[model samples]
Target chain A: MDAIAEKKPVAFNRWLPYWAVFQADVRQTLRSWVYLFWVLLSVLATVGYLLYRFGSYHEGGIVQTASVHVSQLLRWIVLGSAAIVCVLTAGSITSERGTMADSVLSRGISRYQYFLGKWHARLATVLGTFLTLGIATLISALFLLHEDLSLDGSLVALAVVAALLTTVITFGVTVSAVANSTVLGIAVLWSMLCAAGFLMSFLPPRYPSPDRTLERLPYILQGNYDLAGLAQFAGWSLLASGVAALFGLGYFSRRDV
Target chain B: MAENSSSNMVVETFKLTKIYQNRQIALNDVTLRLEPGCVLGLLGSNGAGKTTLLRLIIGLHRPTAGWAKVFGKFMTPNAAELRRRIGYIPTNPQFPRGMTPITYLDYMARLFGLPKDVRKPRLASLIRAVDLLRVSGDSIAGFSNGMTARLAVAASLINEPDLLIWDEPTHGLDPEARRSMLELIKTLSREKTLIVSSHNLSDIDEVCNHAAVLSHGQLIYCGSLQDLKGRMRRNHFELDLEGEQKAITKSTTAIRALPEFKVVTLKHRRLELYLQEEVGGAAALANVLMTLNDNKVTLVSIRSVGQQTEQAFLDLVEKEESRGFARIYQAEAA
Candidate 1:
């Protein structure tokens, strides 16, 4: 037989690796009966809490302030989302090393591809889970409060919250990639976020006595809530997320093991 | 397209040297080449840079100096195209814990961009090829080491790469599984160039078309396996004779009178001697042997001394270690 020269087709774009990783991540995270159970149970608990609080206020013949209840519901949603995102991000990359899937690095899969695939999978998972849970919480809050939330002056507030969530997602991923184990990644990420919160609280009081500039931080003590203040918070979150992405991409690209 | 054997240098490393900060040199100025469709073995003991060289070839780590290329492409992870053309199997591969082989392979196949139509059949075929058909749907948690290795081999082939690099591929396998794995490797060699790094010489001897011995990050020997065997052959012959000691001594002395018999030992009725290759004095020694025969001496046996290649390997390693990398590289180049 005559020898034939051939180019084995490499049709998948570089992004294809990300898709592969995404599938693996989804299968790993969601296929576990425990996680599925957790998702359902957590959403139900949020709904029940919303109903109980509203029902209690109505029976007591007390008019619960709309602002207080709305803030409380948002707080619960943010806190719940934070915990889920942390759990999801903690295992994305570090756990892969524990599992030997890092062999993909040795097997002609670029570390960059491996990392991106993980990031995409993780981004999809955390964001997808967050959206699901966030919507469930929002719906429960809306039914109880009987208020229509609109995107008016709240645009900047929305941006700040989005940015904060992005920062958390990227920061958690960076930690996961660098950490030796999943538990260690989780510990480091949460510890750092907690430290950031504590440090922010200790910042010196604003120089302008009557108009305290330190009131601008999101979820901070002492502030006349406004979009401009939220804008500044959004700026910090964006900066943090961008810096995290750079670190994650750079380190994952060059790591040898 | 017609095959171009001249251009198919599947793996080429030129003056590759890697020195870690810990003062250990993993690879030292190692220049090598592998032709497409050739199965080459990188043989070495522990800490011998076998894994290091494979890592460089796969572009997992950058070379400290010189260059390495796989499938004729430069050694860089950015050469994603080249990675697609090459498959790597680590000594032990780690798959996602709960997923079955089929799910993992299917996912990888899709990532490699095999259409679902193409992926399903190909995945099924590979799973069966590795004798993992029975457990394709089962989680990898319970698989034996050999089964895991077989699954790894199958996964590496998902992209149908033209080059396959295996680092100690048969590391932990039962004898039967090891044999099957080796045979599978041989079968794969027909369609792709392969680089197998192993400390097991028997594995290299069984399947490798060419072999290189690595010790302390230096390539001490590189060539055909037959050439390696030939190099270690003894340059002497033993002759067994049943006779009086005096007659054997007389005959030995007569032979020693010639320049070819460098050393002679008389042990019982056996006389072993070192002889120069292509010696002209064999005829003279035959004449003396004839005289001993006439005097009623019985020539019991005559055979070449047996020297194992494994012994020569040990000697090579010792010699390389004593002189160290500096001398080993010089000798290798020479």
Candidate 2:
């Protein structure tokens, strides 16, 4: 039998090689017209939301509380910006199956590295987009709406949004890895997101009461030294994202590309 | 497995087989061993499992039974080091739409862990080698089929892989491009082990020293090109006559009566003769001419006819088809 003993010792961090793929993917995402279109749409939506908020303030001739304005901005960022994230990530793997994987994978990059690279690259883009929108919204709220936003509440909300974006992007990556085509991956993700939204619409009021331990995980982990609803939301979001990422990696590694 | 463990061997497969989810037996009981520094031409018709075997060797598809080893290592999903020694170009290789040849190769180089200093000059030399220096900076999306093929070739060589697998490298090229590609392949074969799978017989004849022919997922022939040709060579000759039909008929009968001629057929003024295995070419020709001359027959022309590689390939495939084997087989039985 062959020696099989000359196997190169794996490096300390095996995933380090994935950085190259990540960088290439990031460049691809930036150059894509789809990303440009989504970025523009997000910006325009943010601007529209700001205009509507300013109009409400002007018409009522009263300054709304900072929490109300922050809540509205968070809703738009999560709903509107997350939609763009889904679209951007939905084709991350499927589009590359025929076009690039044959060449790239044959060069000795493992499926796990490729999947992880794409995952991290797309997550960076989505998170950057969310941060930019969040900052812009905060600046606009403080300057135009003239409300004193609480720093603690704003940070917690940002953390919650970050967790939510992570979950959506990971789920989108899973869909991308499983589907055979970009269109199919996008359609599947869109349908699932719609289904989740439909289901969430029926939740009862006060579903997570103040006394519930499940409602207090995110704040507990955020160094806020408190247990609250945002903490629980963050915990659940991380768990879902972790499970989706694992599933994507497992399926991608076993299936022929 | 023990017999195939030589360091010189670049690839080895033992009873490798692949069955699709739809019950299509893509490859069955394929046992092959390839040494370094040879161009292996993989020949077969459509659905003959040429691509399937190549994919299995490259670890793109898992074998349903048995396995393959590359660079003395069993192929696996995480065979990164093993795969680093190989470069593969798929049929009709496609790249991301916006990348130029330069950028694309650069990315590939990085994936192979080539440092920046080495990558720059290597990319430049490969671009010049493929004669793509002129358009190396242009987006590959706008390249023609020949240009894409050239880029694929260049990309495959970016890492200086020990083995290169090209699936129909010249399938869609124009005549000039095809010629250039063949020349490129010939040049690369000097230093690297190559597995070129193609349908064009002339291309194989031009560049390959050895060949493996597949039929219905079975390896019908695998050996040196010269050996394959030798196995299919025939002791045959064609004769043209310029005499009366009576004289021609008499000469044909005389030739058939000779023990040297195993089979003879006459059509109009032309005669085809197959010499007995024991008869040498020179002696057989002399005997036929002497017989014709004695029969008052005027011989217009005579030429020996040997089977070409294409003829041999067709004959092998036709023979396999006539056997009428089922398309699917049990994994263990295969």
Candidate 3:
């Protein structure tokens, strides 16, 4: 046999791994058993909650307001999916921990690209689910239930809940990247969620946190909320997510695969 | 540090150390330089840090105290371009679940940024090469250990890396799969710089010209295979004879009377012996043939069977362990 010639790395395009990661992770997230269960459960809960609202209003001889409709739509769909979302995002890093070493460590793939790809894929899932459920519930409340829910109120409520969901997903992914085990990541995320809620309750309502923003989501949707407080909360929440994202990226880059 | 980047060197580690979780000193102060072309056999017992060292060189695990350079650049976790030149087969590879070989290889090729045109043909060729053509469309979850290992081999070569670092490539393979893998390594050794870490010293003896033996996280021996064998002061021999049992029994006495020979065992015209340092088995075997002068006795096949590299490795590890005990003894005494 002739001597094997020495080889060089391919003149690789930098963005390939990032895009591949995003595409593969999107498939993985959508096909996961938990995600399938989540979709089914979310649809059932939203439909049930809508029917119950109509039944309650009819029985009490009271009209369902726009704020009530929007609030409960979120309560049933977004908040209901939060635990399953946490599970999906928390295992995002830990689940890949063993397999990724074979591919990511052996190639020209950046941790930044990998981290962002996974982050963006799960982020897409959260936003996509929220929008789909929000639109469906809005139509149901408007036509079928004859509830007085406004388009502006529904959109505003969906956007705020979307931002808050983004924060939760980002935090969950970061915790997964930082912790060594999926169990640990899930525990830390649940703790952070609880801590955020508990800590925000201690703060005055004028400068509301994201957790506080959710509590008064109805008032916020009705435009009775303080605009200055909403902006501050949005900025702080984004800054926190940004910091966590940077930390998770840096930590993951140095972590042993 | 300058010599590490000297183009001819494929891998270099200077005082490279790794202490995992502040408790296990997985690899300690291992310094070596591997030139291009030599297939280095990494021989170490379980937990001797073979995996740790390989991981360090590939930039999967960072060095705690020193550094490693692969292809002239310091290997870091984020050294994407440098890492692109390395093909690593991790121990018991856990491939992405729910993916067929075709999809997995496609994913791997894309990670290395191969274009659709280049990626398709390459995956096809590699699948054929590793004999995974039949299962190319099957999910990796259904693959046996042998199949998964073959897929991993294909994945490693996706980018045509300059250096191949394989950790226990045949750890769980059946004999057939193991033999095929060894044959593949032998073929690949003609061209690429490979570091194969395995406990199968016989396989190492077959394919590797250079050997590195690690004992308890320390480099006990590192040099050419000939040099490692040269350190052995005793020689081993095995022989088969075509003769009557009576003739063979009589010849054994004459063989034992020879000054240089020590008969280890003799049974049914077969013989095993060891010789003292220097004369080795060849000269001693000649003397034995001269002494077995019975016309009824004849040599069928005579092989100056040398001590396998396995023996050398065991001797090396045994010696290192004793020294370790000695040092601890002294420390306790102090």
Which of the numbered candidates is closest to the native, going by highest TM-score? 3
List runs of model 3 lying over 4 Å from the truth.
A1-10, A56-61, A76-78, A145-147, B1-5, B239-265, B275-301, B304-307, B325-334
Writing each residue's lDDT as its tens digit, candidate 2 over B6-63 gives 5558998889999998589999899888988879999999999998898889887788
Per-candidate TM-scores read 0.79, 0.85, 0.90
Quantify all predictions' global Cα lDDT against the true fold: 0.70, 0.80, 0.81
> Chain B of model 2: TM-score?
0.84
lDDT of 3 at B157: 90
lDDT of 1 by residue, A209-230 (tens): 1113222322221123555555
Candidate 1 whole-model C-alpha lDDT, 0 to 1: 0.70
lDDT of 3 by residue, B1-334 (tens): 1243456688988888999899999998888889888899999989999999998998878899898988878988888778777788988888777899899989988887787877889899999999999888888998899998999999889877779999889989999999999999998888899999998888899889999988878887889988888776556667788767878888887777777865457977788887865575667767777766553687778665645687788778876777755744432342
- Scanning candidate 2 chain A in windows of ten residues, the lowest lDDT window is A208-217
Query: How far off is residue A216 in model 3, in Å?
Result: 2.3
Model 2 has a DockQ score of 0.41
The Cα error of candidate 1 at residue B169, in Å, is 2.1
Candidate 1 CAPRI level: acceptable
Among all candidates shown, the one with the greatest lDDT = 3
Native contact fraction of candidate 3? Answer: 0.66
TM-score between candidate 1 chain A and the true chain A: 0.77
